[model samples]
Target: MQAVIMAGGKGSRLAALTKDEIPKPMAPFLGKPLLEWQLEQLKRYGIRRVTLVVGHLKEKIISHFGDGSTLGLELDYVEETAPLGTAGAFPLLLPKIESEHFLLLFGDIRFDIDLARMERFFLEKRAECLLFAHPNAHPYDSDLIVTDGENRVTGFDSKHNVRTGWQDNLVNAGIYILSRDMLRRVPEVKKTDFEKEILAPMAAAGEAIYAYRSPEYVKDVGTVDRIRAAEEEWRSGFPAKRNLEFPQRAVFLDRDGVINRYNGFVRTPEELELLPCAAEGLRQLNSSAYLAIVVSNQPVVARGETSEAELETIFNKMKTLLGREGAFVDDVFYCPHHPDSGFPGEVKELKIDCDCRKPKTGMLRRAAERYHLDLSACYLVGDTTGDIQCGKNAGVRTVLVKTGEAGRDGKYAVTPDLVADDLAAAATKILEEQ
Candidate 1:
């Protein structure tokens, strides 16, 4: 199938990284040009004709790909003289879209999803428009998409009919497969945003617009800090689908060792001690392109040693502390189960094995679903084998630190994808190439 990559838009938010020269799609990472990885991804997907809708820095993009001959694909360019909303670029590139069905991707987004399966869904459902929807993380981050049980597109985040018994929850992946006829929805003289003006209305009318669900690994490289995070994900050595090219980076922290002192069942704010450098690293992670998250197994709450409210209090304290430091924890997730402890309330809730707790990818997956982060492009920094396993399970890079709990080697010890002496060392390695 043909793939259309939208590479326009001045990346104003990424000014700190681009320094007034290029757009987000052109940001540098992993010693190679970021867009080069995107092109490579499409190549792996067997997309023969690749169309890049260029604006802002059309000349630079033109100079970079140079007709796509070496990339084993037919290259085409559609230059928009003015800033066109996402769907607006369509009319500009309509002439190049030659088939009944083709793919559309936002260049600023790097993701690893099953493209073949998505297309199969389109064909199998007989949909004129198939939008890949991911379980949302931040509804405000992008246009939200909701679909019915039959997979027909429903309402958006705003004014969604929760009573309709429809799965009005997922966010649009910004990737689509639309029939050539769908282009008719585009106005002949004006530009439009597909999400805002077209798809929602058509979906309301029962048009064949639908969604294909996938727990994809993705990233939006639209900021300087996010770009740094992406670079870190690449260097962390986590495993992910080979077809995607965007740099996906994340910082996974341990609850007791990294976030606070390793006190027994840190169940209360009074018991929590905010480490000095931890917030700095978190600040660095949040400021960069990486998703800064906390992945931990807090069995204390489940063991009857603490209450969920106490857990919240502890997290609230951490959140406030981090915010005061000008560092933000994008998300925090923990498991309350202990495999064989069976302590009581904590024992029962923490006893059963589930995928999300540390040593598993549940919490990581939750973050991925919310942020569209590519797991392979993510990293987990902890002090135990469970941390390494969790990173491995989620297909992210794992880093072990020696400054706190994960210092000594024992049965619970794990060989990390990378090891550091402290959070600063890990952060330094975050900026380094593997």
Candidate 2:
């Protein structure tokens, strides 16, 4: 697939490093230019054709990469004579991109992403644009993204909108996949921002814009501090070693007690009710770097109280409710096995020992493999001893919430790293710690 990299920034924020007329993308990172790392990552992901938009000191970029044959890429350049905003470069390269979809990225960022997987999600959703959204350390002054449960980009809040209190922390990760048609929405004017001018208006106008939320490493190296952090992340090799072909961090959640009201084995969709602040807590996670996963023990299937289909319906209802609040869970895993026997109406086949049951770490381990999670860097937020044990068994940090079956003074067989009043409080703690 073809990719476009915006490499025209002047590096005004890093004057010390760029004093020698070097572009921001050409600034050194671990003895190599930041754009070099980006191109390498794109090449590793099977994207060989690239169009670099260059402005200030454009000769350095063109001279360095040239035809890209040395890097095994077909390089193209769009040297703007005057300053054109993010979306302006698109119109100039309209004829070059023959594909129906193309990837767009900022040149000054460092990331390790599964572009193939993101492409699949974008195609499945039939979206005009798919933005990469992640939580950063400084959300208070960052542009926040609001997405529904289905990963639809419902709204965009710029950092200037300070009146909206405690919104979701998901920020635009400066990466995107856009259909050719989407570029038609960009004005023919000389300057336009992809976010403020194009995307925000389209989303508000009911267009299909989605967010591909991931925990994979995507950092902006615009400032001095961020450059150092990006270097450290690259040196540690944590971004490449974890599950899903890249490092991931997750927040394991308990479904019944933590996500929804604990009403003694909820068997039907009508009985599944979300607890207060449950959606809010999940909304926070939906935007953060943590993967919000629901790992619950639902033995009702073994007891024949709820069929697997019925349980799925209940989960669907929960998802719909969360979507209304712009909250989401990346995945849900439940253990339906029960070792006990002789219960009336119990499914005999399900009444056996299973590894997926809570406290055994089977579900967590499976999730780790599926999502390429780094267990040691993850967190489990739940309300029971079994949940705590499940997280500990999976080698992740744990947080116990005073909700559902576990009250404020409840005791657990094993201790958690932290105790919170509810899921919302637990989310605050997790973000703070991170």
Candidate 3:
């Protein structure tokens, strides 16, 4: 309902790029204030009322956003009388956050989060706290490692508590959601962290702390190298995704053919084989920071050819494989309904023609609602005309892959915006345009 942005940090690490001019939150990327992009993302997600916890270079932020009028949002500030750590900001701004539960985001990072979904998830799951997390990037990525099955946050890595053999290689996303009452309990001591003190303690105490995985690309522009990596990533359109200099977009990807495999209907991992350069292509899109998604129609499940549990088995396998390869799906959407036929009992579950199936942007539209995605700037990638038609019907970009048979026939007269032999090549072209 309400959002609080931790925009007050000095961002000591990015001094070279900021020209000693502003805090990291105000630092420019592509001639736009870093905080502006964050504000825009909030607006996209239907968060019109926001509170900025400002301390370092607080004036810069206040002057730029000045009442948040231009953005059509009510903007307020928690001018910390003194510098408080990340966790402290929450308690300090608690008075201003009116919602029973609200969102917390670090201004230093650039991410595309689906807050609408997160809120509903928080309520339905009845969680006290929920954090966004992803796989640790490399040898020295800063994040809190999750344990207790991501249900309880068991550890914090400083660079502390880091040990090899960490299965998920998962790390804290620096994004958080907490109940209003949780803030009242926060200790008001000097110099505290949400990780070492709050989250870890809560988990250890058997609190309902949940870790929400992005399953896509989540980057923190904290270091010079990471900043460059992000810039390069944007320029190259990293995951074979299209680049829009100033366009609002939410990308839609076909599951079987475009994302994983087009082997008829993907029923199991045994039948699932990722196409050539699949991970790399998706990696490029991930880096470009698009809202990467997988939308598929698995009729086989409806036909009783496969079970839902079996479908999850396939996804679990795909998730591991993709994460290892450095390209992960953000959110996956599938339709198990089959209209025409079914196998015995399978028809009961799969008999209806649902709106979520491809050729209909229902799933895409749902994702847009949840993520605050701008579907008008969206793009859809598939290997069939149906995919193109889906994107067309959704009023977004439609691109076809020539690697499949759909491109062979002249019947596909709709003319895809960009045709690539493969996802990577197409992603490369999208990057070039950016």
Candidate 4:
């Protein structure tokens, strides 16, 4: 595989670190140049050939890593004489990118990702463009990517827009896998805004643009504070540990009673109100080594009380509300099936005894498979006996909170590994045990 990096930014925001002597890509990060770190990561992933698009301080970069042989990789440079913007220099690199699909990265960000896993998703979807998307701490102010359940990007929701509706916290994390055909599609790129001019149009045209969402470490270190934070994270081995190539640890949570107020079946988005401690609990998980995932049972869809679209809206409200409090879930998995078929409005086909319902381990097992998670090292936190039973069935630790039903559902004769007053206390207990 091959890679291309946009290394042209002046990084005025990082002038304190760069001192106007180097371009943003040449800014030192943990003693090495930021661009060098990116190259080393790409080389480790077997992407030996790299094309660097340089502009701001081109000479400093060329002088530092000329030919890239010192790094055991073949490197080439493309100097943009004028400011051509993000995708504007692509037209100049047509001859350099020979592979059917190549990786694209922004210069200012530091990331450790599973390239092979992402490549598999790219090839499986046969995508024209594959974006590296993830949930962030603040979706309320970030440009969000809207994708279907299959991960096909439908549209973009800019942070600048007045967002009256709820939204999922999928943000474009400034990393991408682009097909060679995409390069040709940029007809004489001149000052192109990649998101607004390039990707948005392709998405609107119904092209196969997919978002590969992962719970990995990818952050833009444009500011000094972020660089300092990244250094600490790097020293702690957080980035590499977050790679999907390794088995991950997660805290799977039940949605309704735990994260939101459980006042019977939530039939609409308006009915879904977040619990006071939900964000506090989730924020704790977000900072820990564990990935925060939600395994929910939304039988409303099966009972015909809510459509899948409305259920999505409910989840959107849940995520958006959490994001507002600087908290986010890595992913959400829900079972819309119900066993009984005697209801008046129920969807008969979905009224089957599915394996994913409470007391069954289908959802946890599926999450484990998808994320390469270690079920033994995971925990399931919920408010009902069914949740504890499901955790037991999945061979994971269970934490039953004293909120909502408080395990008084009486559906099962199981005990949780731990009990807490609410989600906040549960999170504290989980972290303390670790």
**Best candidate, lDDT-wise?**
4
Q: 2 or 4, which is superior by TM-score?
A: 4
**309 in model 2: Cα distance from truth in Å?**
24
Candidate 3 per-residue lDDT, tens place, 1-434, comes to 78889887888899988866888888776678778988897798788889998987888889989999998999999887677787776667777888898888888987655567667778876888888776542424445455553245655556554545323345687888888877876757355677777877887787888877544345788877777777776666542232222333556777676656665777667877777767777788776646677787778888888887677667656655666677666666778877876357575856887897778778888777655578877788888877887888888887788665545545445778888777777676666656
Candidate 4 C-alpha error for residue 278, in Å: 0.9
Model 2 agreement with the true structure over 1-434: per-residue lDDT tens digits: 79999999988998788885899999999999999999998998899899999999999999999999999999999989888888887778887798899999998898888888888889998989999886554556677787665678878887787533234456799999999877677647488888888888878887889988766678789987889887887787766643256667889999888989987889988788899989889878866667888898999999999998787678867765676567777777889999999999999999999999878989999888768788999999887887887788889999888888773333446889999888988999999997
406, model 4: CA deviation in Å? 0.5
Estimate, for each residue in 159-202, the C-alpha lDDT of model 1 and write its tens digit.
34333222223567678898987877786635687777987788
Residue 297 CA displacement from its true place in model 2, Å = 10
Candidate lDDT (C-alpha), each: 0.71, 0.83, 0.72, 0.92
Tell me the tens digit of each residue's lDDT in model 4 across 1-434. Answer: 79999999999999999999999998889999999899988987899999999999899999999999999999999999898898998889899998999999999999999889999999999998999999999999999999888889989999899998889899999999999988887789588888898899888888999999999899999989999999999999989999999999999999878999889888988898999999999999999899998999989999999999888888999999999999999999999999988999998988999999978889999889889999999999999999999999999999999888998899999989999988899999999998
How far out, in Å, is residue 365 in model 2? 9.2
Give candidate 3 regions above 4 Å deviation. 1-127, 130-171, 184-224, 227-247, 287-290, 345-347, 372-376, 404-418, 429-434
Of 1 and 2, the candidate ahead on TM-score is 2
Q: 369, model 4: CA deviation in Å? A: 1.6
Rank by TM-score (best first): 4, 2, 3, 1
Candidate 2 contains a number of clashing pairs equal to 2
Q: Which of the two, 1 or 3, has more lDDT?
A: 3
Candidate 4 ranges beyond 4 A from true positions: none
What lDDT is reached at residue 252 by model 4? Answer: 96
